[model samples]
Target: MEILDHAFMQRALLAAVLVGITAPAVGIHLVQRRQALMGDGIGHVAMTGVGLGFLMSANPVWVAGAVSIAGAVLMELIRMYGRTRGDIALALLFYGGMAGGVLLTSLSPAGSNANLVSYLFGSLATVSEEDVVAICVLAAFVVAVSLGLRRQLFAVSQDEEFARVTGLPVRALNLLVAVTAAVTVTVAMRVVGLLLVSALMVVPVAAAQQLTRSFRATFAVAVLIGTAVSLGGTVTTYYQDVPPGATIVLLAIAVFVVFATLAAPLARRRARAAQAAQGAHDGVRPSPGTADDVKV
Candidate 1:
């Protein structure tokens, strides 16, 4: 295809697959903790960091990583001790980050808006050699750490209180998780963008949860779904001339809807089977005097 002839598209596809694989690994945990919103929060914060980078003539991705890490840590601390509800804390982060990014962008040179737009919506033309390198390094790190600590992360995710009772270093593990998530979001900006990164981070995991009950199976399936969708979306973008971020995200959502639809009937079947087995064991008959009041 003429699309494959472009080196930029090739790099973008490579970056997309790398990010698609890693984002869901991190996100499966986030979704388990019900912290899937954290990606959106960190992503918004990254925008401010990128804006500051443009102001200072630095690499925006690195700056965004630093800022996103700070934001993630702040969110963890706030959730721990701010006495604010979870939604409120995320909301505070969401607004504060956007406001800061917008203000900083306004104060920058006139042409900086173009850079912000690229960071926000994504640009296939924006993937560079450096971006590819960063994506690979981060992807390796994420996959390694996530698998290495899978049991502990699962312990904490399923029941933080139980994990703490079992002598697990719950707080330390949580901090590590936050930083990892922040780094993933920062690195993912090029593929799906700051505004839409959560879609990729979240939707695949959501779909996986519907299709499987085993946590390990869910994680594996999510990574697979994410990788497949990223490749599909990248190719579709080439042929259709559509936006990469939207195309990828909508595909993930569409996949999730399919899983959800299938899961519903599967769940109903299980429920009915359980009920039937129970009725069979109990002889399907009313007890004692109550039988007189029951229909034949």
Candidate 2:
């Protein structure tokens, strides 16, 4: 109750829920495409954007959004033009983004670096009223672009070569994905910071994937998990005095482990049940571990 009594906490809570809903929309694409770390990379680029904004006396959030989108587009271009593939390229680009941010911050005022740690680890109490508005607008934009192009995005994400074969603009779809991911990262940075923004994007989806096979179900389940993590972490931080971003990420990891552990037994039970039903339909004996033999 004390938490909600403050305006910043209210904004932070709203921001958390929005991030919980939107981060995974982009993350599902990243996780399925084996590009989950892209959020971290873009986050580093966003840090550089923030640094640049500080140097120029501009709004860091806007600058970070612009720089992050540009960086995302640039990475796609490099991958397309250089014919590079795999994590190696992304890894290189990620390091470059971080190095660039460090360099930019070094060149800026001393105070810029002082505030950098907050961006790295997150301090939701510092999320201003204006930040909530920016985050809302960006998150909405990211989701709209993502879902509007879901068909083509899904096609490309599934198989780039196949999407190209079918006459889809694979390159453009890839760029769109990167751009949306960039937006997700920049907006999420305000809540979870650069270091753990990837977790906000990837972890819940990873947990949900363990529970559901269908994309829609996985997405829905992930939203629930993320929302819980956001609200839980924000509240937990009040008592623990820990960084809210770290709290959320650690909470997500715990949730992921719980889901993963549950998955194995559930999967085994489902397999047994399926086998038993097949045996029964064929007029054969059900297996020993079949659902017919075991309590539900």
Candidate 3:
């Protein structure tokens, strides 16, 4: 309770809450599409934007959002057109973005590896009011795109061919997913850092899937899990004096393990029930060759 008195802590908690909500919101679609690593790629690309913000003495959040959006769009293009060579192209993009960020950060007069470290590993204690505003705005966009258009996004993610046949704009929706993911990366940068942001995006959804059978349930549970961990981790950091990003990620992983463990028994019970039902059906055959049991 005392920690809440500090302006910085208040900002950090707000940012964490937003990260909790937005990360899994967009990530569910990525998971559905089997592109769980897309957030990681966008995080990598966002690094260049962070560097550029430092060099130009501008806000890194906005710069990162712009740069990452471009990178995500490019990645989507590669995915659409690169065909057999998409993986290689993406690898190149990932490495190039990282190298460029390092080089540009070195060129900035006020930027150092130490400053980059904060963004890479998260610096919740340093979150400014402006960052909170940026995060809120970005989070709003992510929520709108990920939730407001969930059916369309889900249709496209589940089956692009089928979605296209159903009159959904598959390519456009895909690009929107990519861009939304990029925005989410920027929104989470201040809370979970770039390197671990993808974990927040993907792990909550993974954890939710362990206990959920439908996409809607998964999305809701993932968001709940994400929120719990984000707030829990942030509060833990205040007491333990640990890295907020690492703490959040580790907490998310812990939740995943718990969900997985609990789900095992539930899954086994479902399997057993299904088997029993089948057995019962099979056992209901006419006994002693009754008239209804005549051979076909």
Best by TM-score: 3
Residue-level lDDT tens digits of model 2 in 222-284: 888888998899888877888899999999999999999999999988887787778889999
CA RMSD per model (angstroms): 4.8, 2.1, 5.2
lDDT of 3: 0.91
**Model 3: how far is 3 from its true place, Å?**
1.3
Stretches of candidate 2 off by over 4 Å are 84-92, 110-113, 287-295
Position 94, candidate 3: lDDT = 93
Which scores greater on TM-score, model 1 or model 2? 2
lDDT of 1 by residue, 89-123 (tens): 77878788888877777776744444676788777
Arrange candidates, best TM-score first: 3, 2, 1
Candidate 3 stretches with Cα past 4 Å from truth are: 282-296
In model 2, what lDDT does residue 125 have? Answer: 80
Highest lDDT model number: 3
* Location of the lowest summed lDDT over 10 successive residues in candidate 3: 287-296
Error of 1 at 118 (Å): 1.7
